[model samples]
Target chain A: MIDLVSDPWPLVYVGITLGVTALLAYVAKLLIWGMMRQSNPQITIAAQRLGVSIVWLVGGVVAVQELGVSIDVLLLVIGLLGVATIVALRQPLENFGAKYFADVYTPFKLGDTVRVGEHEGRVIEINAMSTVLLSKGDALVSLPNSAFLRQPVVNLTPQAWKEVVVPITLPGTMDLAAFENTMHRAIARMRVRLDRRYPPIFTVKSRTAQSTDLLLTVMVRRPEDRDPVLAEVNLRLTEAMEKAPASASRAASGASAVDPGH
Target chain B: MHSVDSRWGHDAGTAAEPREEDRDLFSDPEAATLATTAVPAEGRMNAVSVLINTQTPLLQFPRAPRGRHAMWEVESNFSRLVEGEDYRFSPGGVSRMVYPLARRMLTEGVWSDVHWVSLNSHGPEMVRLPGGITLHNVTIQPEHLGGYGKAKEAIWSTVHGLNSPRSSRDLFWTDDYGEYTYYNRVTAELIRELDLAHDFDLFYIHDFQQLPIGQMLGTIKPKLFRWHIPFDSRKIPAQWRPLISTYLNSYDVVVVSSERYRGALRRFGHRGPVRRMYPCIDPAEYKRAGPDDIGAVTTKFGIGPNDTVVLVVARMDPAKAQDRVIGAVARLLPRFPRLRLVLVGNGSFTSASSGLGIPKSRTWRRHLEETAASRGVHDRVVFTGHVSQSELESLYERCAFTVLPSVREGFGLVVVESWLYHKPTVVSVRAGIADLVTDGENGLLFDPDRPRALDRQMLRLLRDSGPLSRKLGEAGHQTARLCTLDAAVRDEVRLSGELGEN
Candidate 1:
């Protein structure tokens, strides 16, 4: 009470930093999401999360310093902890990173027969750390996720080369069935490049009120058309998402506005 | 005081009531069989939600009155046009067979919500029914509807062994096939949307026209397909096998109408559970008409007191082999001068103006009229086209016997209808119901391919009309109980409930 001027300024400064930290984090997430519209949903999510974490960390350091707490030892401890975590979890981090790439590039999926090194069986599952195979004799074969990148894996499923499976995640702002129907019509126009016997199929992996996870599968008429077909299909899918129905506003009530392509 | 003939101004005939005679057809009308036995499903775990998909909509809306609004955009209150005047319910197995099962299952507390999706080019988007049932209709563009019709017809003709192998070669790659896929995709989209909202416990799809729907759905939910037509594996082209198998394997279970078809499904390489259940009917729906009904029917058709009524109740189509029965009727008319042939029915919904509007049924009916006229029996033949349920029951009661002469039948519920009336029936060997007939006991079996065989069967029934008719009629009444709602509904509900629980 007697020295209110000095006390209120420090408290007010800390309060301002806290409020500013929240605003900065929100804006940074929006910018990251806007810049990554064309990227995979996973990458967009990761970038937004990383931006928020950085804003909070810097703002938190300043707020504590305003509170008159020494943060030198705290900064040193946090830096050392980050380095130690990277070193200790190096193997798991590699597997996790490899899983991200394998999801995008791997030709085989669950239920495909794949041969990695001397292992040969039907692929039962693909998890973060390993891929599981059920052998012909009913034995289980688990292989490391990193092995998919380290060695050449042969997919022995019949006509597997013609198959192209794309994983897609629809945001709360997009309608899945409407998006799928439009995506199918857009892809059917390129029937000359696709196998007529096998039409494009969109399968739901899982769904929530917030989002829907899906896998879009198309069979290419020729092996060489795979890359172009993928690019064209992605463009069509992104357009479908962007052109969501008006009811989509109900689902994504607080969705951000700007989306510049990644 | 009941009215006489032509109540609705349907025919230009006499309105006088016929004289009533002694009418004692059966001793016991309630001929209960073992199949009619009931089981209390107290152990059924939970109420389920079901989604049924078919090619034909259960209710077809009328084309909107000139252009007040499009039919598809109209509300389902059905105010624009009258139910019977502008549009009529489809009269065939899909409506007759599926509707009863759905209703009975709902009544028995097996389901919480039941949604049926089907193709309806001219219909409202949604219709709510009694007992928690909802109907969804999916429309395809009219420009593409013609192509869709052609593709389905080709597939139908091929599967029924009517089309030659050469015409069916590479049929799936044609331009029409693309339209067919388009129709199915739109239907799948509608169903997926409904499923997302309702979260159905199971999906029940029907027939070859909508077979690809199972594969297109890609739902991990339990899926059951009922192949309502004939399933002769040898008839399907080798080129179509791979794709057909892919569609069939997508379903958790496939149901065929006969045991022979079950064997055929296995031979067709369907790697799924195949169950053979008889197509059923509800006895309560068919009530016996009183004397006034019989009198009005006789007066309208101009039946004499001593004239024998030989009934052939079938839709006017070549597959129904109505011409074969007409031929048999001509042969018997010379010996039994009292014989009068009553052909009861018009074209099916496929031939109706509101439906797919195929002209095959109309064209075949014209051919039948020409044949009957050439055979010099047009005067003796009575074509009572499209009667009401009460009128049909009166005809069934007035008839001395019934005949089923289909060249290839999926499963003849008409035979079951005839049996329910306690009437002797002569069945075609090619019909699915022929498997249910025991040559001389419950019913007589004849080959529709051989008109003389049907002719002989007709003669035998004419000679020994008393004991033979009564015995066969009573035995048939017992057999009819097997196909009743009380029995078949049990199997149907069990299939759904167990699959849902798993």
Candidate 2:
């Protein structure tokens, strides 16, 4: 190995690679986020993080190789640790993965009375591993998120079928009010097909420094109209999400004084 | 003739001599409305920023005339244009009370700045009211205004128990309500943006038209909603319960005009505390007599010294039941032939020639005129379309008594105005202010439905009214202290501070 760990050249090479790795990881994260900002906010975050982690893992291997460390043993140890972690957290990991799908596709929301498997109650919360419900008898039930995929669920709320909630993610730099106004006007164009009483409303589900999570709720005029309204609204939402960043940037620069919503 | 009658010992019947032209109100433009005065209070209170949302603006701007360009500008510096010439103050008691409250709140240290948002399609986008108050106008399309008006009026009538709400069952599901939602949503959107900029400590929403605002605002900050109309839970339709309840629950606190309304709100299942804060005015805002106030009205309206001015202080709406007063006047004309009913309001902001463009006031005014003529008391009835606040105060001073003939009044603050001037007032039993009336002690209460009941009360007030008026007015004046802005300010500040802290 020619004493690579003690050599100045090797140490400098390792430092340069680490710098490149950080730069590459940051650029990749930004590009991925900018491209996938309209996806479910959780999914966007996970995807960007996963990409950066992969870059870090590969760069660490190269750095160790440059330092002439025992690469085979390190790989073996990392592989065993990964296997042990997966084995120990198998059920939780499955539930965690299931939560993402349920969050996107589940018909029932928090505060709705719903039935799944044998238990029924108002949904108090839905975590990564379990969906919690507060029963009428003041009991709490925690159902595995994965069970939502296997078991048939029934929503007991009035006109629950008329509701279609779409989850959207926007970058932190975007103006929420402007986005809301845009979405409102967009949804208003389909008013004839929608229930007149229930105009579309966008509620901020959660927010973070990097991104914001919002849920858009709309009511269909007929149960049969749900699918089409969802598809049409989704398209409009995607378009508005695309324009929001631009609008926000324009507003920041004082480029546009016209506010249609006002 | 002897001044004192055995039945009612009112002795001031000979104070003013009768003028024949007072019988004919056809030619006087000033009688069409009253004259004006402006006096801004100078004081200070706790420093807080407040946002008030009302469906009706304190001032209204009709479409500008063809040759003129002053009123319909996009934005106006009110200082640049005159009050009456540029824009007229809205004619209902809501605006009358709210404008002064904002003024006093701003003049005093209570609020550092006040932003009022209203539906004003014809007015400028922003108006600077005197002091730190700025009026933000939200104008909806004329096409949408009709639907908004219809839906709001439906809610108003149903809550007031004025008519059977057979049509309101479908109100939330109709296209008209869509427009109502649109207006509230737009107003809420604007409010939210303003909140972001101003970071207001409190949001005070008023009346039924903006009920949806609390929910639409979607802010967790403390919200205080005032239901200015009658709130009898039984009168609310079954279908409206869920919808109305949802909107009502959005507020941190619900304030109504009376304890009765507070109880009704509790019965209606309002989640939070229901506060009974009586809508009040600045007692000083009302002048008992300005030197020119009485003469200006007498010359303009053809009023004579001998003619007894029997006043009805309300807008020209069927809900106000000015016709009931007219009917009562017709019956009383036989005994007190010199008794003239001076009906002192034209239309509210909801009426025709307004941004809302509802024609109810014009139609109702014609109906009242027809009612008076048919009752053969046409010439004896005086119609003053609108009046300035000082002129109203002067009229309050000149009149022997005032009548709040509303079929269902939220709170007869006009009764308080009458009391402030030491003028006895006859109020309807259904009025929210009737709770304050002690029946022959402070004010008289009657039922508008029973025309004869109101007829007799008017006769007693007119026949032997002078002594009774003096006593009632004196007692009523004691009660006025309880409802003035001065009295309510401490509680308002306490409530706002409590909400802001927690």
Candidate 3:
């Protein structure tokens, strides 16, 4: 209508920017994976997600700029909108972010008894918004998940320190039995650092069409060995995953993710 | 009406009417469901769907089903295949007890449907039994099966108190243990797959071989585990306590064969609902063989008519202590010159050619033969590898007495079979059934760990002065009622009903 075919360079440049951004996002994902290969897989995954998101955000801004938009004004408006949203969802955003941190960093799990500040009860549920506790008198107590991060929480369960649960996420098509067998053999090699009485056990947390989530639990002999054992088990799990055969179609429906100890 | 025996203080005789306990066990709605093809009442819960996992397959196919016989290709009805020719019911507690129980429950509509999963390497993927029960056979590579068999055998040996030196306390750390886990995981995976379709109401797992399955299964559904073997806390290694307790606690209910085992489970730190259910066999499956049947069995085994046959029906394994019975027989040979010991049974599924193919049974048999020969009693002992059910019944009828001489024994169902024939038995003190025996009243008890204890007990039966043997037999026949299928069904019905409520 307005002689749009006269100069298609802006559209072409925008398309090119998006194409390069995709390639860069993939490269960033690989770099994150390689760099944090020896670290906890959760950290690696989070970093990879963060890296790709930043690449896309920058690429999107550049693509928009190629359409003759003012970058300074667009970014100012975007920043203000993001700030306003965060302010509006401050409580929920805090709780949601805290839940992610608590999942990886908290000492207690769903079944463990814990004391946070003046509150103490058996944890019955860990939901998106709040952690529910069943009191000894049969009363239900709901606490904000963000409280777990702010307060010094003490796990009251016996030998809670000995437990180290590592979370895992795998492709739905991975051979779970073979992966489990490989993990067992790998964990067995570190028996000296582990409590011989309790072997490594994997529990399925959830499953989906694309991925399975699992939690791998191991008991350490000494409290000091918890962090090291967690790191080493994560490393071993990654190695096992790398070597895992691509087919466990039988158990694909029961794939799972992992989390640290209760 | 059923007569209550004063000595036992329980109904020892069968009646045409359901017993009082049976009425209480199966409610009116359940009885109504069993009586006719009718649905349960409005308030009553529907019949439950059960997923049963056991180590023993219900039927053993000589080879894997293929082509037209493949499970996916057919309706999976196994009635067309002639049993014993195309397949055979596995010779153990599974076929003897579990199969009949499933059939009875199905007929009664106690269960809506049942899917039984077992490790049967050479069998079809699935087979539908007569009563609409689906059998899911789980197969693994032979090499993996070999490792799994070794680990299971080691656990068996440990639990039975065989105490082999090579049986390390750190068995969970071994590579063979990985294979054991692999098998359980595969079975659990299969069960999970089935649960998706059937949405089972309960999962009942049998024996120690599948103990880890309760923990491996992610479902929050009710799980019941039956520990079939001897479960002595002292016999279990200290290193195995935590893992064993963890696996055991994962179940909603844990059932053992004896009160002693229940106590032991408690002592072993199993903090769960523990119920003691005595292992049972269907008495209807056994028949009192006639004189002609006994004669045929005697002739086949070359046993003389004058011979005082002492029968021992158990698989040839070191734990069974068949050699101990041979030693006792050797000691009593001079006293009773015509004494012939008949050891009937070959190997368990683990030792079978189509199974894991472990040669423990064969090795144990050869050792037993050598032991008999060394004691100058080779010809006196008849080693009938394995016999048909009819042959076993005939031998039971022909025997003067049966002896269960084991270092450690689970509830000895063979002793119950011996009691069925009204044949006095000398049961090991370590057996779970020993709790039911009153020394001189129903059955004789012997400490297999003590030297000459079994011989002394056997001598008591051989040298019965008056009505000692007959009185013991009559009393034992009463005790046998406590271990029959009817009694088991009552207990099982109550247990499953309680599970439904919770």
* Model number with the top lDDT: 3
Please give the distance, in angstroms, between residue B446's alpha carbon in candidate 3 and its true position after superposition: 0.2
Candidate 2 stretches with Cα past 4 Å from truth are A1-100, A113-122, A125-147, A150-262, B1-46, B63-75, B290-292, B352-354
lDDT, model 3, position B326:
94
lDDT of 2 at B279: 86
Worst-scoring 10-residue span by lDDT in model 1 chain B: B1-10
Between candidates 1 and 2, the lDDT winner = 1
lDDT of 1 by residue, B1-502 (tens): 0111121122243335422322222223343432233425641447778888888777665575455454435335343445554455666567677877787677667766788888777776665664666777776666667877888988888877778656786666665766777677667756766776678888999888888788778888899999988888887887677678878998999988888898888877776788888888766556667888788989988888788899988888777878887888888888998988898888765666666788888898888889899998888788888887778888899999999988778889999999988899999887777888998899999877664999888888999949999999999988886677767777786676557566
lDDT (tens digit, per residue) of candidate 3 on A154-184: 9999999998877788887787777888899
- As a whole number from 0 to 100, the lDDT of residue B206 in candidate 2 is 92
| Candidates sorted on DockQ, descending | 3, 1, 2
Model 1 misplacement above 4 A: A1-105, A127-129, A137-139, A158-262, B1-39, B43-45, B63-87, B302-307, B336-339
How well docked is model 2, in DockQ terms? Answer: 0.08
Winning model by TM-score: 3
- Candidate 1 has which clashing residue pairs, if any? none
When sorted by lDDT, best at the front, the candidate numbers are: 3, 1, 2
- Judged by DockQ cut-offs, is candidate 1 incorrect, acceptable, medium or high? incorrect
Candidate 1, residue B401: CA error in Å?
A: 2.5
By the TM-score metric, which is better: model 2 or model 3?
3
Local distance difference test scores for all models: 0.76, 0.75, 0.81
lDDT of 1 at B236: 85
- Quality of candidate 3's docking, in CAPRI categories? acceptable
